[model samples]
Target: MAISFAQCFLAVDDHDKALAFYRDALGLEVRNDVEFEGMRWVAVGAPSQPDVEIVLEPPGAGPGASPADRRAMAELLAKGLLHGVNFWTDDCDADFERVRARGGEVLQEPVDQPYGVRDCAFRDPSGNMVRFVQPRGR
Candidate 1:
């Protein structure tokens, strides 16, 4: 009953590029980076979720992922079939601008979403959408 979900993993085609997006664009900290058995591994953590990490794994890195699966995932990413990762920030405008300044493509300008959140959206290097939001008037 005390189990905890420590992290969520996303399969990317390029680890270094993903790291650059997460670290430079999203402003996440790279907690760990390493390689094993011809595979590279990296993790990023939010400032508040210091203990929780998001694993950025390359396609076909897992046993269940085959060459075809990797190709399929790459195609899907290119077509923007993946859902974005949403993050809460204290300054959505600041974060959005920072991301754009870093050569990150912002899919949406900062605006008040219908859910009462002021947000902006962008895509990572691998075509994964990521949203940064802040509470209105905060």
Candidate 2:
């Protein structure tokens, strides 16, 4: 049997703002957008990778979460303490510039890493540190 990634979640305070960044800025296509129990989930994926999707969700979306739990999660997300996703790119510099030009919050310029990949970072509308990496010497 082979295992593969299906989806991963990222917390966002505003779905529309997240869409502007993920779809418009990064060029990912929206796979699905659904609302349930007064919460929303937006699934987006790179057009080249149809099987994988990133689910943008509100903080404390789980059914078991309490109001205080949601508040704590929102605080963590606001502080950029929540985890984010990294993407593989063919051209780190070009992708970096594209995201920046589209008004993404820049965290770092593209830089070659000692471990052999060039990468850059940006904060999403919700303050998650999204990174793009391209293998070195490609």
TM-scores for the candidates: 0.89, 0.98
Residue-level lDDT of model 1, residues 1-138, one tens digit each, is 688768887767788899889987677899888899778779898888887888887765777888898788778877778546888888999988888999998799999988889999988888888888798878
lDDT of 1: 0.83
Model 2 TM-score, all chains together: 0.98
Candidate 1, residue 12: lDDT: 72
Question: How much is 100 displaced in model 1, in angstroms?
Answer: 0.9
Instruction: List, residue by residue over 21-132, the lDDT tens digit for candidate 2.
Output: 9999999999999999899999999999999999999999999999999999999999999979999998999999999999999999999999999999999999999999
